[model samples]
Target: MGFMDRLFAREERASVEDPRVPISSPNIIAFLGLDALSASGETVTIDSALGVPAIWAAVNFLPGTLAGLPLHLYKRTSAGRERVTGGLATILHDAVNPGMSSFDWRMYMFGQVFTEGRGVSFIERNAGGKPLNIWPLDPCGVTVKRFEGRKLYEYKDGSSRKVTYEASEVIDIPFMLKRDMLGHRSPILTNKDVIGLAQAVTKYGSKFFQNGGVPPFAIEGPFQSAGALQRSAEDLAAAVQKAAKENRLALSLPAGHTIKQLGADPEKSQLVELQRFIIEQIARIYSLPPTFLQDLTHGTFSNTEQQDLHFVKHTMRRWIQQFEQEVNLKLFGRVNNRQYVEMNVDGLLRGDFKARMEGYAKGIQNAILKPNEARRRENLPDDPEGDKLLIQGATAPLGSQPARGIGDNGGPPLNDNEGNDDAA
Candidate 1:
């Protein structure tokens, strides 16, 4: 073959061998909350919560054991005005420079449990016994405020007029997480446990909100007024439970004592395969493709040509890194050269090339099948007899009904017979 032919041959081989077909996998999610406040009698309070499931999965699952480590939850609060070291009036000059108060220091000394892939849900009772939505605030827009014992004076024009108002106002802050695994049913976070934890956390967090500090110029209202946090917690708990049950059902086998047992037997291999097949069928029915799966075995084997698939390698690496940071999960598998390359190329073909081809096919199909309404209006002739024959030959069966149009009933407005009669 000529050089050009040889090059084309290589390209064709690579296209046929593409490995990244039918991407299928789950995504990571996250949630976070923080509060700070100061109130009467020099009281100050700060609270925070962070969810890092992705991180947990990477460290705990990938390496085969959960790492014994502490995740930090930081908080800060301001002390009240008092006598200053310099020769300055206590009221005029702030005594404390907003350093961490002793109370805040003590609170942080005993670090809080920042568990991975865990959530708490609870019912919040408003003073008036009305339902509230608290979910939105936990993972979205939230604020805190503090009220000091002292009062502030608002002066009107002249005559040393003074209006006493308590010091308090609200401050809003936003936090973003790398991932949120709220609804997943991982062994690490069971459905009942997650629900219980969510409930407990919401109960405790509410207490902090209610009894914490009040901000200047702000009147203390019901703590659970913003029902978003509580609602989210409940929803998350429910979802976790549902997912756990489903996951258990999916992994269960008729004769096996455990999921691992089912997976271990060679005889039950077909059953397991059938399960995956059903999952794929469901995905197809929903018009969703499988998530990407990486067989890490390929890279470990001694193969030069396999390693040359730089694009696939880079993509997998990036995915792994994201999984680590967001889910705390690490993937460990030896890359099989043949399977890796095949899957990678297949993924590329199915994703990029297949999409492009489908688009082109759709354009052609529309051009051929769609009646040229504008041409018909202008009284233009249809294609030549030979072209008509070719077009007819190219047309596929009208297996389904066409979409509705202006003043058209829910049926094909015109068929071949009708068109023929009109032409005649």
Candidate 2:
């Protein structure tokens, strides 16, 4: 639920931290050291376009959504209940540094998938072979190779020493992929053209603004001397800069010289629209709504909410499922087993308050929720008989048979109804 608050918030952003990748060349190939980069080539690594505001919003929104949700490790009990309070909770929620919370760890891992298309973590085990700490591995620094049918993961250790791990020891979460067993595809590389366009637009805007929104001016000259014309031009330029900065209305120009304003204004040339179009393109590249990137031009009250939900269901849900499945596989060592990890995704799917209350009322009416249970969920006080599960003129303990309005209070057989009714 706390995560839901973070997700719907408009100002929240995530900044992923990673070491600088080696410059790409013939010898050094991919960003994450995978052949998949050869499939489409990673022009925009995590370092490239990440500085752009649109990319920042898109990348951070994902990991922030993931980190906000609650992750629970549960042991399946025989009575069809999951026990969440276990030793595994420490590793799931508190295994990061002493100051860093569980959200920090989860955000880091989730952010990796966006940048590298794979999130790799090392499971450090104790003497008893139980998980001790889950350490994140830099995808760029990591290289995956196969040896005689076995997979070997190579990454620098904490001490910067080269180390190798078996496939079992590493938790590898691959993004969209085809047949490259040791490779993973990334959005930045696969959609480089779109991202590159966005980056170019950003650079163009920056250069446009850096020169005070004016292009280089041309000086008309047919002077008596070349050096004199140059000196006059330099003097005019200095006078113009000083006047502009000092807020002077007029500049004192030399007599035989005239001024003509140079290039067209950015507004006239639709530069703002161009930048906005690039923002929309970047949003599309990340499969995020333009509104998510602060582009509310096309947003409406009705469609905005639906688009946000679509962002969660279509975009965020993909990464969330990836995180969950990989976590389950690495933590439990089995996909279909009694012990596993589950993410609380209901928070994101929940509707507004009126709708939620109406749904809760329906649940209580159908005996799916007792009055006390609903009250507890809504943080309300429990009533005297709130625990009673009421049905059609009858009441019973949850998961138990209705008493048929019998006087099962261990008193005399009086004041009881034959039909489903409450009695005194």
Global lDDT scores for all candidate models: 0.26, 0.70
* Model 1 stretches with alpha carbons more than 4 Å out: 1-51, 55-352, 368-424
For model 2 the local lDDT of residue 130 reads 81
The residue ranges of model 2 lying beyond 4 angstroms of the native Cα positions read: 1-45, 96-100, 158-160, 249-252, 260-264, 371-389, 392-424
- The positional error of residue 181 in candidate 1, measured at the CA in angstroms, is 25
RMSD for each of the candidates: 34.1, 11.6
Model 1, 154-223: lDDT tens digits are 2122333433222221101111121221122222221223323333434444443342211112222233
lDDT, model 2, position 177? 51
Q: Pick the candidate with the highest TM-score.
A: 2
Instruction: Quote each prediction's TM-score.
Output: 0.15, 0.76
Residue-pair clashes per candidate, as listed? Answer: 73, 0
